[model samples]
Target: MNWYQTWNNPLKNLLWWLVIIGMLGSLPLAYMRHETETSTKNVEFVFDYRDLLDIADLQTNPQKFVQDQLGKMKAAGIGSMAVYESTLAEFKESRRIDLYNSRDAAALTQTFGDPSENFTYLLFTNNEAQQKLEPLIQKTFADLGVGVKPWSFKNRSGLVIQMSPDDAAIKAMDPDPIAMQMLKDQGFQLVVRLSNHREFKSNDMDRLLKQLHDLGVKRIIVDGNEVPGYTEENTEENLNKMADLLNKYGMGLAAIELLKEPQKGFSTLAKQTNYNVVRLHSFTEKDGDKLTEPLKKSELEGRIQGVADRFVLAVKDRNIRMVFINGHAVKSLDRAKVVDPLSAYYESLTGTDGAIPRIEKFGFDLGPAQPFEVHTTSWQKVARVFLLIGGLSLVVLMLSFFIPEGTLIFFVLGLIGLVGVHVLSANLYAQGLALMTAISAPSVAVMLAIRTVRSGASAKWKSGIGFGLWLLLRTSLISLIGIVYEVALLNHITYSLVLQQFRGVGLLHLLPIAIAGLYLLFFSENNTYSEKLANIRRILSSYISVLWIVIAGVGLAAVYYYLSRTGNEGQASTVEKLFRSYLENTMGVRPRTKEFLVAHPIFVLGGYLAVRYRHAVYLLFIGVVGQLSLVDTFAHLHTPLHISLLRIFYGLVIGAILGLILCAAWEIVARSWKRWAKPQLLK
Candidate 1:
């Protein structure tokens, strides 16, 4: 036995006490988080007005089609309409204006086309359109060094632009005030869309925003990858100006979920506005088409249901409070008709067990999403200091397993480094400490489980089940402390809203298992560190075999496969997805498959058999997966706290049950082997 194993090891006791203190200190922060999450339960459903116009343009009477769709959407509980900045092409599609090229204009007048002057012409549909658009067009074009002049087409007022049709088509125009007023009058909230295509001056932005604010617009979603004020010429300075205007108008931004990268100026704007942002999930036109392509009735219904399922997950699990839905017209060759998924989308929201009702059942109601009111308190900072020391202790505890005599040395150095990091960058310190705790707690838990199993190596069947269950509970509790420290340390609204993430997830996933494996091979089985080194040297000096090479290759492949399944982009098979859906429907929270099906079962049965067969200690390496997964579950900061808690509970209860079954089955197999197969093989 090592001197550190003595009962009076003061350093060991101090580390454990710090871990306990850290866990207790984090409880208040957890309660505060619960308060923050429950305060915002309103979910907004937004329809893409541009998408509606595009689909309407496909109909025989575009005006009638749009009115019908808007009424249907309002009936289907769409509370908001997302209106984009207009282009000339979009205006033509909306039937607000008619466009003619130079040749067409010349032909209409029965005059030859001018060889040197190719110009674009626009004819308003009515006097109202002419009054609203003509001056706006003239000023916009005049500012861009393009000439605009009054013209007449028969009895209608029109404008002539010196630029060609293509150039005129792409120019930026403000969102149509007529449409905005109509939608607002129709009882729809407007979510204005902004683009940075045109250079925005402070005064221009202020004017545009003031007009929208007067029309009762409360939120803006960007039209492209960059926010409205983000440009190559000026970065965050422009964002600050935009944020000031948004804040002045009492408006917020809708942060889109799962973008490949965040909008360039999003963080600056969000921070400047005190994080007046709500998470939005958008299902694009292409996504709708993918679900309905080669559309069979049964297939369409199933896929639509799939969309409802996703919306529910987004609201009830992730903190997505706004859903932006887009659709396109599809040509149905089988029926000889053009169709859009608008009705189908309506069904997904209004069906008996659809997203709306499901989300409401989870305590969300249909309304504008409220942003998190993040007000920091003095106590949270004090609590984090405790959490930091606890995290440092966990790192030292795990190190003690490998370097038994260096516990005090490691803890002192870790303390100094953590304090330095915290002073330099609190965010960096939080993430680093969170990662250390995440890796250390799981590795320490698995090591403790191995030691417990070793001490009970001579236990009988009567004690095995109870002993294994106790170990499972104890090890999980240790791993859960890592989660507590992680949550408390990084418990800012930015993490809850996913504006910042817990870094080093890849390292967190890999290190615990590797450490547990190292402990299993060298530190367990009553061997000293020097003796373990001798065994390694003796094995290296021995002959290399083909079987060993094959085993090494297989191990490397297994590691590769494990890593591929770790992050958000992990791939899953069709059958697995179906099985997951089944579990989600049947169980309120689906336990992770790796936990209940694989790791927990092995841990349980391995605990039982390790007493009888020393070789079974190796199973604890695989068992470390369940422990680390418990910690990793909370790393998804966007998932609701209660949902994460429920998920963890389900995983533990289900995993424990499955593990006992494996133990029972193994007992039966071993008895049968002893009775017949083992004796025969011995002969």
Candidate 2:
């Protein structure tokens, strides 16, 4: 089953031409993506104002601390402040008003507690506070059907509500107007935060948004699990209403990255707003603790470096333009003082080797982040069809390796199936085709490498090295074609922002390796098709041994471990993390560890060894890891195209270097065994 001979059939030849044409056609889509990504050059760092206030409250002078921190943050390159929906507790902390629970109010006024009911009390701290917050408080409790009445204390205005202080504290309200004005006065941009915790009242929310619009707020980051105004049954209508308000006010949404799941109604809201969205990365309190909790200077520095690296990756690799940095206060036992992470946060952004400079070096400016301005062309439809054809043909070509006669049949069925999927859901069609290309491309590349190795055996070490390097380059190119096809087919902006994603990632990681192994087992030998089938039967029927069974168990464990470490959330050893940091710092883009360290070296060694030992063909199964990873790299649509290309390039160069070293070592070991060890054994 010579691969070249298989392509001698007209059908296979036609399929190859289709794939080539598809690759050529998809160039425009990739170009479009390049333009879109390059168009967005502004990155914004936003400090969480609520978190700041929470932290500030822990300081001796809350107001002075906030003012001082804001000045420092502005100096440290923070340009915006994110304000969350307000609560009574927050207002009390900010000193906009004085709030008192039933017991406290009773103690302060020298009155007995109410016999059966508890009521919350609020007192305006100043005339300005009274003028601004009086109507808001009255209307807020009035709408909830909770009793509200006027009160006076020391000639200052206040309100009494017929709810327990605890019950009153949790009620969501508008973001504090005073804080918005103060932040605006400080020359900070406002990123209003919203949540779906309150009852959905379209008119009320409209007024709130209109007020935020007047305050010069430009973006909103939704809190909790749902977008503001989202409702279960009337989700569409609610999102449409929210989208209309956002559009009317000229404000966009920031889609937070790495959420447990996407916020509900976000995709719909984004679509309705004509995709007015930017990717946002949030540095949570947990992340802050990693940097500030460590008392040792070296440990703290390393943690800060890790966070800084994430910021750089977010801005440059992922299309994250907005970063939300949280703050927290920690009680330090050794220092006997309350400490805040504000200084460490500043260091993360503006230290000597901080995220700000690194991101700016990568061509981003400090400004308000803008949504990607995606420009669509009429020709993209035709280009997508070509990409679809290319993917289907690639799939058919892979199938032809095992079922050579079914090339035309598989193509026809694939075409029909894709059409059906497209008619039902375009996203499904794109994701399905992308997965097919992902699997088929690597399988085909590995199979072709095997064919090339089998065609000639280079006994000389130098020839083996050259042959292996050549095969590596050729196979990588073949895998890259799959990337082109995937990029073209799933070129929707949704994927770029991760509002939608390329599905079947786990399958993409595993299938090609399995396919390559099966192909090697069945077809690597020069035997008739029936003989190959008989050999498989004989092997399956062979008697088992305990030692072999133990080896298989270990092999399965290795496979399980390999799969566990494939995705973004994969666990890595501390040593590996340090090594990765070194690589990233040295290279500016860290090539994946598995690619350079494991897959690529194995591939290079496999190519060299296949010529010397027939059994070495099994190494191609491992080699398929690198090939598939190259293709899978592009499946992460959120990663910028150029970054993925750079990563792949680095992986190849470094992997090839390491592979050559392994080949040289093998040669040394073999020579030693033949000259000394083998002769002694023969005696």
Candidate 3:
């Protein structure tokens, strides 16, 4: 039959109409679900040149490469870069590091040979040693090269010098003015980073300021320079000197790790200074530049969140501007491994108006009187959800009473109950548990309902198996639907926020399946044991001896399982990534796959099959199978909530399409079976 004929058939036509209605209706939901990429552009990015390449890569055209990478960094939302006095290559070239006492050369050697290894700085820890060795190194470098000038003092907790290399060695040893100018032209803020080494006390400070001023740097980050708990009596001279330096250079200061002791003094400084404070928190202490793996699900995001919380408090209390820098994938492929999770966590912690991101965009708006709050739950939103649930419940009840749609009423009631359960829960995981109850409760009800009606009926054991698989398919679909609505419209579910929803759900979800099985065996209908052969014998006799068909089904199921496991199975994979990337590139956001492909199809197919094959107990079995799929899908709470909702939408679309095909094929099989089996099976 063609389109007209198919439409004339009630089952096929209703299935199509359901698909059309679901897809069309979902368009609005998808639109509402669409999200904008939250910008972290306010973040100041740090680049220790040694993190990118070693002395070897800097042999030729290194500045060109470094400049290109900096361009990429700016494009990727880094607002500022910090300049230290020395890098490994510059140290190695100075020819003075060799004259000093031997230290661990591992950091320098690792970067030299491996182009991929460079995510950390070679932190020379001996400030005392460096202070003593500085003059010798400076004198040695001045004599070693022609026209070599040491631009000195205070960086990385040691005394070091930035050398102006001779014309011939410029590309190999020093920063090019042209490339530095390009960075400035690109609007990249340059900050001179210094430490509290003793050599920076007097004449060295003046030289440092003049050098920075000439380099177009207007910001400075000084560590340990300000006296802790600085009071008028002890720090009067230091404060005067700092003010003079700030005024003369027209530069701002960057403070870090200054909140712990004498907080009130820092608070006083925060009001008067334009310094930006960064909190010290390392995600990884690994050597070299490769990013460590992302935070695992087991380690509740308290480490990061704790730091952010404390940082926010200090910043607000002090009225200071703050910036967040990462310890993982700061600049490389798979940057989102850390960046996105942090962004999502901060959003939850601080909401859309997060102080950190706000500081990045607008800078230090916290007045002396203003207090910062991470986020507050909108009671208005909660009320809206409550009102919607009540209104929708009433509508469903009205439709159920007027139309006498038992299954629709039951399912709609189940959905409304899910929302109530989710809203009443403490968090996303609890909400998911409530949703599972919703998926299973109706499923158990349907199974019990089927048992009551089909208690006196009978069927071939082979048909019973098909019916079981069919019920599995149905429950999975319903479970998927609940998850989608719960995730997208209700909760901001993500891996960082919620634990896996599979706990306790699997057993409860499976209990319904077991109950369905019992109903099939005892209450409903099934082939009885023969005089010599039992339920097994009848099914063997009834099922056609198509070895090829059995093999084909196994192969198809295996292929589907493998593909599903690898592709869009539950977790985001390469396929999901590529598709999401395309969507994000084109549409700025992506939806999940299981929505259209897995769960939605199961719902349409399972419901229609349950309706058509009510007497055979087929749909319930398939719906049960579907419930398993749905459970497995939710087992992956590692996915973002929006993506999960998208998956359900995709599943519904695919399920409806395939449901049409399955219905058409089963129609022929049903007719043939009527002739071969007892007419009572049809009833």
User: If scored against the real structure, what TM-score would every candidate get?
Assistant: 0.96, 0.96, 0.39
For model 1 the TM-score comes to 0.96
In candidate 3, stretches whose alpha carbon ends up further than 4 angstroms from where it belongs are: 1-50, 55-59, 72-186, 189-612, 625-643, 668-683
As for candidate 2, its clashing pairs are none
lDDT against the true structure, per candidate, is 0.85, 0.86, 0.41
Error of 3 at 417 (Å): 20
Looking at model 3, which ten-residue stretch has the lowest summed lDDT?
Answer: 367-376
TM-score of 2: 0.96
* lDDT (tens digit, per residue) of candidate 1 on 1-683: 46544532678878899888978878788777777777788999999999999889889998999999899999888999999888788879878899999989988888898878779988999988888878778877887999888888789999999999998998997888889999999999999999888887899889999999999988989878888888888777888899999999999988898888988888889899998999999999988886556767888888878888888888888899999999989888977888788888888898856788878877889998889766456688688778877788888889988886777778878889999998999899989998899999999999988876666643644677776777788899999989988888878888888889788888888899889987776776677778999987887898889999999999999888877777788778888888987887677578888888888888877777776775677776688999999999899988878888888888888888998998989889989999999999999
Residue-level lDDT of model 2, residues 1-683, one tens digit each, is: 56744644788889889999999988998888877777789999999998888998987899998999999999999999999888889889898888887788888888898867688998988988888777887788888899999877778888888999999988888888888999999999999889999888889989998899888888888989988888778888888888898899998999998888878889899999889899998888887876656468888887777888989988888899999998688887868888778888888888969999999888899999999989677788788788878889999989988877667678888899998999999878888888889889989999887766555543444667787788789899999889998888877889888988677888988899888888777876567889988989999999999998999999999888888788887888899888988998889889988899998898888878876775666676688989999998898998888889999999999999999999999999999999999999999
